[model samples]
Target: MSLLFLAAVNVSPEAMAQGANDEVVREAQPSQSVQNVLREEHALFSDRLTIEPGISYSYSDRSNLALSGFLALDAIFLGNINVDTVESHTTTFDLSTRYGITNRLEVELMIPYVYRSSQYETIGAGASTGGLVEESVSQGDLGDISAGIYYRLLPEAEVRPDVVWNFSVRAPTGKHPYDIRTNSRIVDDGEGGFENLTVPTSLPTGNGVWGVSSGLSFLKTVDPAIIFANIGYTHNIKRSFDDIGSSEEDVPGEVNLGDSIRLGFGTAFALNERFSLSMSFTHQHAFETKVTTDGGPEQTVIGSSANAASVNFGATYGLSDTTSIVTSVGIGLTDDAPDLTLDFRIPFQI
Candidate 1:
């Protein structure tokens, strides 16, 4: 599983400071346009006692070939020799709320629902038998619940950029993967033979362990354009599972999934009073996973590390003083990343 994090906007001291951080540099008269600029405050943070409700949808597709340890080398040359071809699709819907406790502090809460579908089929293992096996599975469940707080570290200024600090924690409120039961069946190989196979299974909605993340965000005002950068890290706490294996055979142990480092930079251009465009590049590196087997020594899982990167384009359009719509499309730049992702969000302040 993977996570996409959102970094909020910078908080300034006064109307002039906010203007300097977003729009003043582009206009000839700063005071005369204060009201027009203030109306776009949703682009950054909400005012005190304001509550904002938002929803976002995301989709990703990924595919890979599974190879046996012994035939791993041969499978490279003979692609069809691989055991199975796996394809997966994931859809996530997040309902979230944000409220401002003060001008420089904000709190947020989010709940997500996830749906996943997967398919696996034997390739050339039994080509003469019209392929050995075909399986499909689908599942949906509630995802992790998360809460966060953002604090302004530095107010916007002409010489220095606006900076904010964020901390968040996620609870394991969703169904755990280890608790899911595995299913298998015997299928025809098309060559008058039957083969026993462990069919493809749907994935869980959340990791069973608790997670905490912290990050720093900074944004610089450049008249018609605003440039922002963020860096963060997430650490998952170790958790014991009753059964970690898929088959009937059980492997109970303590699992430490991985710690990830994330970084991104983006720029948004004000197309007009009601619309804006943005582009960003993001990267995340997850360390190798570690596991301890029934009080045994800890061991690293091979090929558990991941390096993912993506380029994203976004647009924001304001419908009114307190409502806005945002949308983004992301394309993976590395093999470990999802092939493509599309997201849409609508935020309304009350």
Candidate 2:
């Protein structure tokens, strides 16, 4: 298990903060209010601009396999062993900059990196399973890359509060670092000890992820607090990594790619001008699978879908008029993640 929380560190989100007006934000310009910084503001510009470079840390707990039905079987078949099936703590950090174009239309770009360490006990399966040592997977460099654009629509309408339209993207940039596989089967429940049968015929591989995501977001002010929600679709391209296994005498690079869809909702509450908190939830479904081999025909694996759920909580505290400290935590309610996490951040407008 890693020490960092994969959920706590996202380079780019719909961008929820104090500035809900229609404007353009980038990653190069600096902000006028070094002490007054928006949690989601990132940009770099000449005149009306703001630039922020921040790092976030989080601790989390992980559990069961990400996929439920046959997909779980496939994950086990590949190299995604361990299946967690338990809770573990994690943390993360992020660095990014944003530029403000105008006040109504702004664009921001950010890149987040993470480090992690986790500890879990591997129980016994049957006479045919393998066991894992009760230890931890120390640390690593980075995670994924995410970016987004926000536009304050209905600026004049003000039907209720503030509403904005947003679009975002996520790229596969995390550590494909390898570790010893765990032996927790869906039926066993970590009872006895472990079995070698749980082990694949061969070694596992890394993750080759390339994805693009976009969604619509809304923000409404209730007193001193802002409630926001977003629903979007994440169409993940096929994975390019390979998993080589030995079916008796087959040593071929066996890897496949399939598309997936995800939906999410999040909100933030402000206590005052310098302090605020946020929460978010998201669900994912993996639909189809397509695989090709070295000396075999292309195979399309169908009739399988996996489901996942996630929750995130965070807070911001002002250090001065131009600098503030932020802390956040994340929980993988469902099997979609590895464990639970706690994260921290520091931001200031330049």
Candidate 3:
């Protein structure tokens, strides 16, 4: 998950030091372009209550191959080989609300609903007797709910950038992955024997653990463009589950999900008062996960650590005085990342 920080516009040093005899320094009013960019960066601060509704879609496909026998003479002999592929689609709708308690302090809350579909395919699973076996599963449920607070440490100035610190907590309010059960389907082989294939009956909507994150963001405005950067860390609490095994036997265990570190930087260019364009790069690295079964020692899950990177492009258009449309597209740059993601949001201030 990406951590977003809040920001606010500030008066320049010159404006604050101006003498009474000199021309009056009128209060700074952000143009539509500036507003759009600030909102995309989550830097725009408002004293009035604001509500934002957003929707996002992401797609991912992964493939794996396994060989049961080794080749003879390095080329000629081969045994059973199986190929497994998984394609997943996820859609989420969320509502976020923000309120500024003071000029430098703000609070926010977000609630999300998620729907997911997945297709699993296996080829050559039952030696040479089986062709292709496929299974599909879909589920919809509530997602994790989160709340956070933001504080502006330093306001933007001619020689300084705006600095904001943020902290957030997430609750495990969605479906638990460990609680979902897997079912097996038997298919007849060429020799009249049956082969069993197991697949999950449902999908999880959340990580099933409490999460806490903290970060700092900085933003600077230079004429027609705004530059921003942020870095954050997330920690997941370990939790115990009644059944974490895939087989029919009950296996109670404790799962400790890996923590993650994320970094992002971007710049937004304002073409006009009502439209703007922005591009950014983000990367996250997750540590290895650990699990322990009842009366068993803790073990690290191999190949569980991952690095995900993506490039994102975004645009914002002003619709009315109190509303604006924000849209973004993300392209994956690594195997662990989603192939593509699209996000749309609309913010309304009361």
Candidate 4:
């Protein structure tokens, strides 16, 4: 891998775009999900309302300049390099919806229209300082919008016992504009740090932060080729009513991602008349970014706990008798998000 790491792996397909994270001091921000819902697949139909037209590819390499931790003594007050690495990417066009409003209740709707791209590099400590400074940047829009709701107080399909409850939201419309700064004062900070609470997650378009997610998930099923394993946890409460900045230099404190705990497990197989296969794993934890500057004084940063786990292999082809079609591919043992992903679903019954 060396066309410069294969063009950083084909620009990571998009690299989760827009300032892909790295900031701190906190004012409340952290709650972005692409369905870790116990590895997804729970709709025993009680009311029915499932509409999905999905296509997702989320890649992340997490690194956009470390300079040397805690701003590394202000990097000699800004002269040149010694940070090491940074990466990003994106690809989306999802239209998810699930509704079973009765038997334990349910509600969810997720929409993503991302086409983002990114790249950044810094490795200087030679030539007396100034040896390597990579450069790469890309853009695309119609991203940032995740809705949520789920309630299943026990019963996602046995385990010794089970549970589920949730709520999620992250809307900005996506195209950029929350604080987009960088003329080189140390560059890198496109509002992905939610302005300056240090960091939790953001990409800006218009007033962000309004995530209220609850948690509880447990399951275990292993029998005659219908195996299983699972665990989950969710917690987020960020609210920002809108304050672009310059109102004495807004801060609007309210952040929490110090890692909201989401650990998953997967295993499935029912290769029968139609066919079946599955795999799953998940993890979450990372936070401690404090940036309070309404009156100034509260600038902390040092975060690295956005771990990801995935492994899915599935297929179910049956196009008749109610119809059926499912395909999946997710690979990323740990990089927090995406190293590979491919999914498809189609179920009918009218």
TM-score of each candidate structure, all chains considered together: 0.80, 0.60, 0.90, 0.26
Q: What is residue 153's positional error in candidate 1, in angstroms?
A: 0.5
| lDDT to native, each model | 0.66, 0.48, 0.82, 0.47
Clashing pairs in 1: none
Q: What does the lDDT come to for candidate 4?
A: 0.47
lDDT of 2: 0.48
Which lDDT value does model 3 have at 143? 96
Candidate 2 lDDT, 1-350, residue by residue in tens: 00010111212233333345736554322122212323442111222334455554434454454322344454544332444433333344566555557666666666765555555544333322264434344555566777777665643224553345566676766754222343423444357443322332112122345656665554443443444455556565554334433333444444444555565555555555456666667666776655666677877666445666778777767777556676766676765553455655565656
Per-residue lDDT tens digits for candidate 1, residues 1-350, read 11111222322233233353575543222221221122222113456333334333334445445543354455544333445555667788887777767757877788888887877666544433234566788888998999988777776677777677789999998877764666665555567745544563567889888999988777666765667677889999999998776776778888898999998877766665556777788899999998887868999999999999999887777677566677778888987887777777666667
Selected candidate, larger TM-score, 1 vs 2: 1
Order the candidates by TM-score, highest first.
3, 1, 2, 4
Candidate 4, residues 114-138, lDDT tens digits: the string is 6655555555534224445455655
RMSD of 1: 6.5
Q: Which candidate wins on lDDT?
A: 3
**Which sections of candidate 2 miss by over 4 Å?**
1-38, 41-90, 118-121, 125-139, 160-163, 169-171, 175-207, 239-260, 264-267, 286-289, 295-305, 337-339
